[model samples]
Target chain A: MSAVRERNSSAWLLPPRPGVDHGLRKDMRRFEDQDEVDIAIVGCGAGGSTMLQRLARAGWTAVGFDAGPFWDPERDWVSDEAGSHHLYWTEPRVIDGTDPVPLGSNNSGRGVGGSMVHFAGYTPRFHPSDFHTFTADGVGADWPIGYSDLRSFYEDIEEELPVAGEAWPWGDPHKYTYRPHPVSGNGEIFLRGAFASGITAKVGPVAIANGRFGNRPHCIYRGFCLQGCKVNAKASPLITHIPDALAHGAEVRADSMVTRIGFDERTGKATGVHYVRAGVERFQRARIVAVAGYSIETPRLLLNSANARFPEGMCNDFDQVGRYLMVQGAPQTAGRFAAEVRMYKAPPPEVSTEQFYETDPSKPYKRGFSIQTVSPLPITWAEHVMAQGHWGAELRRYMSDYPHWACLGALCEFLPLAENRVSLSEEKDRHGLPVAKFSYSQCENDQQLLKAAQSVMERILTAAGAEETMTVKRYAHLVGGARMAADEHHGVVDSSCRSFAIPNLYITDGSVLPTQGSANPALTIMALAARTAAILVKGD
Target chain B: MSLPLSPRDGGERYPGFSSVDESDHWDRATQGAVLVRLGLPPDIRFFTAREEAVARALFDQLLDQHSDPRVPVVNMVDSRLAEAETDGWRYADLPEDGQAWRETLAALDQDATERHGQGFPEVTLDQQASLLRAVQDLGYAKWHGMTAARVWSLWTRYACTAFYSHPWAWDEIGFPGPAYPRGYKNLGLDRLEPFEVRDARPAQDPAANAGGDG
Candidate 1:
């Protein structure tokens, strides 16, 4: 019997239903000249796609626009590095300071589904402690709303996307939407270390569908989770939210790069958005407008919208449009076990040990990090193997050990630092808008966090009977260029993720996150977008 | 033998499968149609003749895999640059990767020429290895504004990326490329698929890669 013939629908992408059902193909596309709606959402990635779904459901005549092309997986994609060339936001940005972040697809994705198209399904929620960073420790600002505030939104989102996970003894306010994925050999190797070190490890609550749910498919575990899943198994926004949004009488237009916020008076309120598509200039009018272009471009839009009324920028009256940036300083640890781990055969994040997720008073650092299992693709493995400053036979020996390697990445909670932020560069894009400039350096607390996280990860790896362990410190994702705070003076947006100066404008991407929690930021961004959507639906 | 100037294009493509699958399309029309171009460019897109020579020499030491025709690591890298697919970020001191390759390769050839009369590719394998060691040592002189250490790192990155992305390289590492519609079911620590190669060699001896000498 052939595996191809008997293979269930879960092994492949859900074909765009029968007739005029697929979002882009449906009778919803707007003529470029006639572009006006009640709500206009920018950058149809995670936040925009999630907000579009909720807004469409709430009966807001919403239209979403993305700068990149709408990806039709069957027509456009094959799981390869070639796909990354177009998918990643490869626009040139000046990265300054000692530890400037790795950009491109790593920070932001460029297409219809946005960064979610490339992100793994490692969807853990933020701890309650993550919300009250300032209250617990006097270093960073605390989130205006806490865990209890967004708990329902998280639960609703979990149900909608239906994440696969197991409940933990450590308090999480949500329930599993689906049964956890089966444990893999890499997971077993990681769990052995965690158990030996007396740390609690559980199946990570990933956004991957475990079984056939909605129109999406279950994870086939082909092991290209970071790359766009050819199968609709991974719960990317393209498969999960965008399709739902389009079905509900909403329109999503791609290749439309929103360059400026159209405002009679920006601080007074937003009237519409100015966008360019196919080299044709178009203006989209809306009573309500939202900017969900992730962290870099979200702030870049506000900064670029500096008009006669708002001299500096639309939301930058207090110079808070692009401040208090937070990127979780990640330090990865890899270990080689005698037994073959076959890390490549399973999903990237198989298990998560959040035992160190909270602050320990005994430790010098105020916050902590969690270690989650990870194994990179072949190209990345080869690069890292050679990075050990050896070549020839030694490098060859390491390549043979790729099947035997097990690894974990620590997501340390990062404090929002004023100096670490995005700004508009003098250099402009092809559209004449200033490129997003990134400036960041790891602070003393960040150093403290890295040192502590590295020590614990090394300890965990050592206890697992690893022949050897390697630790590498690097940057993960970017968050909080336009953070949400209660006061207008403190942040760009209010607790509702609405621009305080411009009441009609809302920002609900990673940009609105005040403090970065030690989790993959996508799920939190979606939950925040849902909460904000609820508020927008219920009025002021 | 040189590659075909233009591959024979197959007209129809079976919807879901890629060019890599022989059953899907007899001739690759589009999956990697761009990859099959009108002959190799007169000069590799990003590299100068000198740089190409250096890359050829360096990959010999970097990959050094025992294969029938050592996987064309340099050709793969040339294709990537021609497509302008590079790691988005680079050290501020380094020029844009396209220019950086030319400068660094020229520097490597110069260094080799100074030691011996010929360029990198013409040198003996042991001499090429010695030159690589010099490049790794930070104190070794650099040209065209890049440090020797940075140049060595750059070459190593491209060499490894190009080498490991190919099926020939996968064969050496015992990798079964691309589990797609058919996913792996036997995920036990030591279990493998029927086609997958199980590592028969014993584990690395403790003293072999002890991390001290480098």
Candidate 2:
């Protein structure tokens, strides 16, 4: 038989009901019948899945709904050519642009696993100053909860995700002891060069490679992670928290899109969420509704759920639900070395540097940025470097020889400005829902940070004996649109991720981040979700 | 009787010819042989009118070069030729339905497949079917298909290389090279220059295209 035929035949090796639980079926039926749960989670991505697991473990029943499909690593992993399918979040062109560029990272996974399926799994805690940007830097608002309050939650999230790295040695409260997997050749080179330059660098924790801690297998370092992993290595919500939630009778409904948040006007609280299921609009009522539909869709849902009591939109009484938008603009610099560094085939770069995490008032910017080394495949690297347009012979030659190229990038923090907002576009989808239009820009401080980060990256590359180096100036990682704070007047959600205007509605996604942090936001988002779950379960 | 020129005599007659240059001759000879084996006319003009029109059609058809090789140049040849022909002429000389054109394409496809083990049109069609299957099975078609047309329009306008290399063209028409963008610096069209339309043809030798040193 041909290879294709043999693979097709072997696809049925597993039972039809694989990864399904009897308790989950029962809970799903309960949700279908409109049974009330403690919370109705609107999304099942990274944040929603973590929240469900925490809430369920704390003895609260929850039902999670996601329009995206689940990911099965074994079934999903194919050849490199077919790996692009792993990046599918929503239906292609669902969020239409003239260029058809995907709205976000093929970062979003729809199905059971959500986007955790394709996540790079770098987990870094936000700096202490990140929680109090308004007070410290005189920009953005302060989080109701400080780094001290979230420290324990961050530790819990890291444990749940089972990261491998030594704790921060600088005596920061958020630091914890971790044994990260050994660094690769490129990672080691980056570490040596960064440290030689007096930069604080270490093998930061990644949410992969635990030896069966949470019923998930250890990472096999396949390096095909951006596609789904067949070995259950990556700590995605699908394999980690979602399964735990299901074991505790929590349910998840895939392909179910929540259209609007149902509200009881008299009490000024959300009653339930009305969603579309298989072309039918059905109402699923609950005492509490937690919108974890990510930063963009979370605000879009609030804007779409407008009622007479809150004319602007649900929870938009202050017109601040989608304001204060920020994306972590990661301008990177890459250098080619004369070594046979197979960076692409290895697990993601497990180490990073935080020498620039603090604010540098002497420079043009008040807030600073963090630098990290990452491993990328030839295709991904080519996409980044060639974005400057060095093609044909020069492109082919560069790609063929630069397999050992090392990259140093900065996760620069963007100030949460009120002008950066998400609004409904006049254009509507097939379902007649208004498309989301995002208007965002970087401040002068952000540009300065980028420039300084570039200088730092160039210096490090030069120290590392790099033959050639290039820098990317413009890039973004969407975050901080619906920030969390102490007062409802300044922010949308309160300290515990509860919307002050709507008591029963909680948002635990990137939207609740008070300010953009100079680190990967996934770990922080997971930590916040865990924190919120603890509060809601304790009835605080 | 024309006397056969010795290798030394040939080198003396054509200074560019030498024993060391056999590889270049071999490359040109191989290309000529392949065209002949496929029963295509030596001149690219035999396939279409106007060099630009031929280049565009070749660009569209080249997409299927890797997948199916049974598609005939005749399929893309006539439409381009007809457009060029109409642009150059005021009155209609032949029927626009292009019955002769269709026949020419059918004959070319059949002849090429029989002679050279593959033809452009058949291979192009088969490759397209395969791509559609891949895209549909991966759910890309369902997600991106509705908007792919619009995306293609924008991609063509902004990134012409992307349009030229788009994989979908292999099935729909036989286009090639929609590989991921690499080594492409944004020049912003400021380097536009005029080129003389020369009667000289491009060198068929593979070495001439190698290294791009030429």
Candidate 3:
């Protein structure tokens, strides 16, 4: 007992280190501007963080640059929704088109963990058909790599995140690591509705911890998942990968915004990156540069990095850098019930069903949507109430009845349209770079799918004994600006997420997805980063 | 009026639920942050005196807060604008949120002078709401060189954000505020945490009695 007692503390089951000791080390190794590392990753979010960890473990020196702060969640995050707006990338961007997607905390984040810090912790994997939508349903573009390629990475990341849920019967039919957390009142209403509607539902696969794995604690059921988890119960790269990456000798430089990828004119390969830290411009040299700035910033960086060698952009030789931008049609329906469904008491994501993920012959749409319980806080609920044309006394009245309402969101797979894209606007940011001007409009298919999804949501709510229901049209999870394809003629990157135009440059974020499925994009984005890091380690 | 769990005039739905009491059980950081909403609001720094008057009237109409013990929404909104805590993206057609707020407030006064022969704050609540409704009815049409619908979105978005972040508003909504260290264990349908109070008017359809300019 005395000899093996220390080893039996279950500490060996944890990933490299207990995640709580994320102290911003003052004496950590810092590379000079002229020192060339093995890899320089832009945006230390899901993709960059994952790649940095893998590459560091393989004995490759790596550095990551993020425009946001390296957050100590306990200090930086609060339980209040309005106080948590600092975590989002709230830089001024221009939005246009028939349906302008509202860009703020919902879809964009700025900190070391990126959007996952504020994301609702729903980490469902994309369906197998999502890899080949063109082959299966004859609609959207097929991914260069199939679901089988990212399956192992997904499994590994799931164990790393320690995802909690019941055994999933949808998509590829997998089991999560931890048993499902208890369902909240909002989730119960959703399950009740799905059962009544003859649709099967399951309790989560959210990346939030159920009990405990490492130094991270269990979820507090505080209902502030979108406002950055201060309890260390949720999974963000800041905890899941960055700590391990740091332990393995990866340097993450926070509040340093990478403005452009520096390219060698003669070699046609990436030299490094030009970034700005506290208003001072600097350069970090690297053998390889990976841009993981998600969709908008990734394409924005490529387009802004035009040189004498590639005047159009780094990977825009065939004019496909900022094309095929996509967003899931995330419309929410809130139902008022007789019972108190205090949705803002637990984690926002608790239950989901992918029954309508594939196309049905009876439905007019080619692809379908997934339904999840989305719990909006007070301010968000006010917006939902006002979206239904209620103001004045009506607004106050509806908002006062907030405790009895629960919401359901439908993530309809909007097709990747070339015209719906992110281009550089004339307006400049504080860094003097042209801001991203995102133009979006629903196509005929998108409009139809949304209509179908909204109808189904209303039906489900009505079936669940809702006295009244109101639908709000919104969008979530921006992806696919610098997409991957089989050829350079139609896409920016290749199957390995390497730029076809530049040999050592890679794009390993949601921007490289050829088509985004109805599933949340965080898991797929991380999986892609793992795949890219594996390919790089293989010397391919 | 300052008593615990007192009814808020005639519209109090959760009669005896005090959101401030729930604050005591929160973590120290959260409790400190939330309790500040009850203290003195920030001064109006972004808007002028006239702009402030017009904006306050607009918020009063928007949230239906006609009398005393207001949530200081105008000041909250002013602090946001003065601190540049905008909601990130601005519509390509519109200016930044601060500039748009100024323009819209001035436009409201201009519209009031045109329609009612008085300023927006000087006009009756009925006249002010009708003028606002006219802009809302425009939908996507132009009003004073800016899109009417977007201006409405900006005004309501800021107003709602400010109003709903207060404990007074939370009390009216029966939201047990800031559950951090002390989390709920009872999670089933209609299950209440020990600190949470059940909704008294759960069956009442708020929409049925909803009355405004429309």
Candidate 4:
């Protein structure tokens, strides 16, 4: 066998080295020659990585399979372009072709660290109303659990991740004493601007310990966290829980693409997972299976796993596996200044204002919006600005001084719409697996809310001394395709992240988000993963 | 957020550089020498030629056509020489010896002035002759230094590093300068006069005329 093939096959033999966990080494060894494992986790990203660590600590023998390679701080950033595309495990040719092509939505990673490696590190708890969004607003279905139920779990996640910034007094409060310090100048400017215009704004927490409590180093303000942190400061799945899990004896296999969830002839539960390794198809049996391959890939796997007993595909009895998609508003606005302001040299903005988070009884829409601050570099700003025809030397002259620009955008809450769905496309990959195609449209209420939020953004920027401004029309905050609820009829999973029909199967990614909150979803997803782990540990 | 000192604050001061003696003749020569070391084509003839009137006339004509004449001309000459040298032009390659380089520069300066003078009208010959005399008395080295300094100042303002390789300087200027040209009015103009607002001309209403005819 070639060196690369040998490396791929022997990946599991290398025991978890110190500080390098996430079960990658262990998984590689467990599946090196064996045909099956006791339990299999389909993804090695944020949710999957977290689950693997928990399972390993609990002495559950599990293996993880991902389509991409392990995270290497030096090689990953230098080789990969800094954008949303870096999140996925795509072919080289596809990456080359899609480098310049902008997409409408961002997806999760397919590598060792998975999407969590590229996450912006913004973490926030879902409010009480977020859990009962459907009951409160009569929009989507209610989650199986409430905010009160998940509060302690949220604290656990915060401690594990060691988030920065203080908790909001008005929002779901936490007992954790560690609060992130006040956000820097740019963040304060955004909050001030929002408050000046009657919008409630406050400092929000991010999973950036910055060397306060963890072995991870402090943020160097390199402004390239999305590309992968070179200093290992940010709490990505690879850096945090994944290593601990691997040290505790969990195995993680990189570049092993799981094709289907194989089931036994007599039993309805999954018996094993069929995966492709170095062009060889192999079946690995496990007592329990966790499909943490994200909303997109998880459903695609199930839809492809067709058989004689379950003709419609695994867990397709209700045909509600890929329904009720919710995506947040993509509305954004930017402003330019006269002096130098190096906004891109620091971590992403640490403050967020959710004054309009709840539904207004008088308004046409049932849910309000949340506005957050972000600072981008000149090149990114130029591309977005020039897309609106602000081009040529005039634009160049305006961008000559750094740090003279700032932006505020709204993540408008999206109601779960059943018509928005994910389906297998006619397009196939090199392995003959069908690609996931998404069909989505915003409701009239969603559009109105987005429009109102955009106007508010414009007014805030104008008040903050912005001479010029512009907005991005479409958003990419994809959420809620495989929602969680109390019953199988209305949702795919329950509050504990377990599928309503399958006893052992669970999903801890954005797939279980019933209602899209008006904020970044990373924090909520982390909180849910922690909550799921707690529930499983308590044997509930 | 206090704005940096205005451009008139003797331009942004650079450390380890003398700004006290603006009229010091030697300061100009040193500036011109630095530009030459940075691969720029120095005006060697400006430091050697005896006829002040002819030199002054040529300098004035160059300044009139190109707002900042020194660096632009040097850049053009260096680029042409580089191309010619690459193409194996005999005269394009400078000698290893410093003196030989100086001689070649002097010859190129003479050729440049002849080409520039060829474009002017014959009626302005007498006026040009008098200005050339004044330039000769000013001393060639002194004049060349002053011109080089002015060019460097303009280039630095736009964040260009034709004479410097400091990355910090590039970052300060926000790198790529203005995307649009300052336009015809700013080019070579000594002063920027206020523009007069003109009333809009009546719209050419072809429809109105056509209706009346119908």
Candidate 5:
């Protein structure tokens, strides 16, 4: 963290005390010592932290654990390309196959805030039709629960978090109370292109607060969203739900990496989580257990928790724990502008067009993508632009038009292919845990989606008066490992995101997304977490 | 906290994990590790002296930088090779990066010897560029025994990471570099902070500052 400037004559010099047991040590001597709680959430990321808030508000004792330490943003946050690498999940997992997935720290995260610390806060809700993709498009599995099932849950989360944006009338289930953030320069150019290209565009209902909301400051637009948000403004769970849960007597054990879900072998019910902290194995007893380790680690944990009763890994009766992984495309197309768009001047883009989200038979793709205006910072520019060069002048030529470069990319929808998945590899990680081996391949449906996005983007950028369109990259968002389904045998988790085989186990993260709509999955993950919490409150 | 295994000679099969015992110091800062040129260790860990010399020569031509005030691109490559930190996977036909670098350098030297009657490092910059283009253009030479395009990308990725991660390169591009406690307030479109510099080139022309016939 850098020197702080004052706002309202008093700036937050440091974050509030996280919890009473924020950094409690695990006493290995007391091997049988089990701190019993109402709920035990493995991973204090977006979903777990959101669930923690609800559980605490309902007056339930909850404890959360994270593999990484609690980042003291004031002191620990770094703002460079090298420094940003620390914000993402650092465990070794092989992402291979046809498309060499950049499935490392960039897509996942650890620590208290989890990946949301590095997420762009582009939290768009999935459309109502997104829940029934199988029925509408005859492709992809349908979500067991519909938009109406999680409508109020979405509202509950939106009200608590400082989310901004107007609700889309097309398929948005709930009314977003707060308005969207001001349009960025990138958004203005994108809007011009969208309007010209005969498509729809609107400001987001993103998790970023419009301005100063409560104690959190407004967006200064430092463009470090991919890195850790040092200002505590970017609505990461580190600043939002984690703090609230801690205040409500929820205990958080940072540096506690859960290795297995402890179970009663006889009844096959989850006892709690078995985690290693400070080189000691400890087990906490809980009435309920949830693994919210995003997409990768969630399934990895399930596969690792194999035992006698459920020898094929706990709750993995169908061996569907790590199958059917979906890496949705967040592709970018670079374009040169006449003047200065200053696309990188602000925070993440406020406006995004979703007119192409539905299943349009006229289009080449089964589903579509949402394209928004954006610009790359210098580091990304160096990799994607300057990297392909003849010599110094080639790199320099790309750098010379820094002020005049603009881009619009898509969070394209991806359907589950049985072959594109994650499984335990022969190699082991630093912890001696079996490393996740990926078999990902971008299918023809993805190419069709990209072609649609490319045509729309070209028209939009051409409309926005772009001088040239450069390279295109398909950045993937990890989704669909422990997918939720109405039919028990068809998917990993049931409608409530609870394991159909194991009663006490729940998988509530992006892993539960049966279908990844053309929207950033953070908002949906949080809403589902809230919905799961609401269901648990009903004693289901 | 204790990471379970003590990696020897920078063998991370997967790079960038600290003692995984705890997570504060998770990354070993492998990419931009402390830039030290003090004692020089007297020798290289991964690249052979011949490989290093030729790779450095090729990069100098590729980056159009044959001078000081340049970021240590060859050192960075050596560091990555030593750590076994790769781009994870590459083209199936091409060997791993460590082997690829060695093979490519050997080809460039051999090609230079055949044409200019000199080693790759001893050739003129023009001759060096042509030899490099043989691998890139997939010309009359098999070059690296791999596709010319793959060889080009291997060198390009290493050179780009080393060049752009430095403060010198950040200054050249007018990038404000690193956002932290001192975040931007003048954040509107076309707005610049007092510290930020405007580009001194034709803004619209994508190829404005090629400094060549390009």
Candidate 6:
């Protein structure tokens, strides 16, 4: 039998479901223009989608507003990288500071699922030390809450995402719900390299389905994880939470860009959000409003809603709304081997290790980073090659050697520097709203962690018998613009993610993260939203 | 003789692999997009005729497309600019990417004239490469009112994005093109999917051959 026929045999096939059901919007509830909803969520990505699901399940009338289209993955997403450009937020912003973070495809997303639609399926949980970074290492701020507080939510999200992996042994040790998926060639190389370097590694806890998961199909190892999974196997809130939210009477309004959060000065609370849809400005009133537009836009919205009562910006009484922005020092190193590694097979995220997650007295840096296998597609591989200053025939040569290369990425826990911030610039978007001016610069600790991380990657690759290695300097996952802290003076929101100054306003996204751990923030962000929804429900 | 736009013509590096043939198994949309990239590329909608001429020459030199059947990188970039599908952020020092592209191409011509008494497109390949190298070697210094390093960044990013997205580029690199409904079963180290091709020149480190530290 052919390989395709053998793979499609009865043993590999799941008990067939009809197909992926994306018609959840069919019976979705539509609120009247005058009706005040119980909750209004902004940006239907990881956090907002989770919030919408949880709030509606708790019998609250909620609606989510997304700036981009309501993506029917089948209709919208393509397997090609450049063709999938519509999935990213492509509105121009001014990037500055010593080391300005590149925006767009790497760090931002558009449409109903937000960046999660294009995110690699890695979903590692944050360590306990992440919450008390200041207490643990005397650097960065502490989260208002702890890991124990969100532990149950993380477990719940894991079951919902139905993560597949070996029993995790590092930090807050745990086991996954599904058995680990088969490791790919690139992943096998990472494992071998880690072993040869005397470091530990495991298969995955990626959100990509390993077995039958609801109506979602199993992963085919198609290698287009970054270009929006055409296979429903990869977990995005689009499939994981939004359909559930719709079932529970939540409405997701796509192509509706929320411009500003309307304030009620007399009540000292939020009224609703003003948004633009199809070039028409409209308002949606809600008793309580939540901003989950991730790091950049969440703070941009708050700062843009500056009224006479709070000229510095709403919830920016202490000027902490858009401060302490953080991105992981994600430098990827690719090693060329004698055999064809063909890093483009399977999912981009296959194996990872958090063995170097915490601080060591021997190391100069206070925090550490995680090493993981990263497989870049042809276009992304070309970018990786170009980042090393290769051009002309030299660039073509490296790219042609694509099949011989395997890659590893480091998620270095860079300390949040106050100077690495997002503020409104004089320039405006097509909507006439001021665009975000993001300034990012690495601190001493951040620089040290990156150097160490790159060195370790090189060491592992060299030990694994690589003929040559190329390092590409990059960053990933934006977090912390409107942070959650112990008091109003230190953060924009409280432990419950409620705005410290405005009673009815809340922020539930990666923006609420005080100190990010080395883990990918998707799972943590979803857990935080889940926690926030439960708190609101319990309080009511 | 191969046609000027033949997808099969550019797979010289990986003589055995053809991403165009591999596209037969891809889903409709993906297959359509990849095949379209191999066909007659889009017209010059964003750049002026003069700018397009300069850009075509620049992309050829930057990508080392020295012969016929070259990937239409200039056209791909022009389409991106026409649609305003920008990368979202611009350096504070430089103008928007579209405007910066126009200004820089003009500057390249001016630099060519100053050094070799010719337009950029008319200059010798060696002279063009040297001029571009001069701009790159300026690092952060100002050239034509924009940071030289940023100009290099702008040009290379667009050029690489356009070039590598083409089906011919995938063939040249031995990439098996888009795998969708048909996913891989053989996933162990050094195991190629039945349809996937192995590297023919794995022993030769291109960086070592070219003395590129990268």
Candidate with top DockQ is 3
Residue-level lDDT of model 1, residues A1-540, one tens digit each, is 123212112112235331123524555645343456779999898799888888887777888989998887655554544334566887767666656776775666888889888887787788887788888888678888889998888776766665788885554645685788887777887788889998888987888778876455566776877767766777777777775566566788889999898897524778888999899888888888999999888988998999887889888889998888888988888887777777887788789877887778898888778888877776777766655666765665567557777778888887888888888877676798888778888888888888888888888888988878777667788899999887988898888898888878899899999888778888899989988888888882
- The model with the greater TM-score, 1 or 2, is 1
- As for model 4, its CA RMSD to the true structure in angstroms is 18.9
Model 4 Cα lDDT, one tens digit per residue, A267-290:
667877889988888877877788
lDDT of 5 at B75: 82
**Every model's DockQ:** 0.23, 0.03, 0.66, 0.02, 0.21, 0.59
Which regions of candidate 5 are displaced past 4 Å?
A1-33, A173-175, A386-391, B1-51, B76-155, B187-189, B207-214
**What is candidate 5's lDDT per residue for B1-214, written digit by digit as tens?**
1112112211122222121112232222321232232124324678888888898887787665655555667887788778766654445446656777788788878888888888999988778876765566673234456666567767877777666665455545555555444556764456666566554444436443334511
Which parts of model 6 have CA positions greater than 4 angstroms off?
A1-22, B1-13, B211-214
lDDT rank, highest first?
Answer: 3, 6, 1, 5, 2, 4
lDDT of 3: 0.85
TM-score of each: 0.89, 0.70, 0.96, 0.67, 0.84, 0.96
The runs of at least 3 residues in candidate 3 whose Cα sits more than 4 Å from the true structure, single-residue gaps closed, are A1-19, A22-24, B1-10, B212-214
The list of candidate 1 runs beyond 4 A from truth reads A1-24, A31-35, A81-83, A171-174, B1-43, B65-68, B110-131, B139-153, B205-214
Q: In candidate 1, which residue pairs get closer than 3 Å at backbone N, Cα or C atoms, i.e. clash?
A: none
What are the per-residue Cα lDDT tens digits for candidate 2 across B1-214? 1112222211112222221222232223223322232344224443334333323332343222322333333333433345332111110112222332333234434444554466534354444333323322342232222322222222121222222112221112111111111111211111111110111111211112223310
User: Which candidate should be chosen as best, given lDDT against the real structure?
Assistant: 3
* 4 or 6, greater by DockQ: 6
How far off is residue A2 in model 6, in Å?
Answer: 37
Cα lDDT of model 2 by residue, A107-135, tens digit: 34556656666777777788778878778
Clash pairs detected, candidate 3: none
> Which scores higher on lDDT, 1 or 3?
3
lDDT of 4 at A192: 60
Which ranking of candidates, highest DockQ first? 3, 6, 1, 5, 2, 4
TM-score of 4: 0.67
Docking class of 2: incorrect
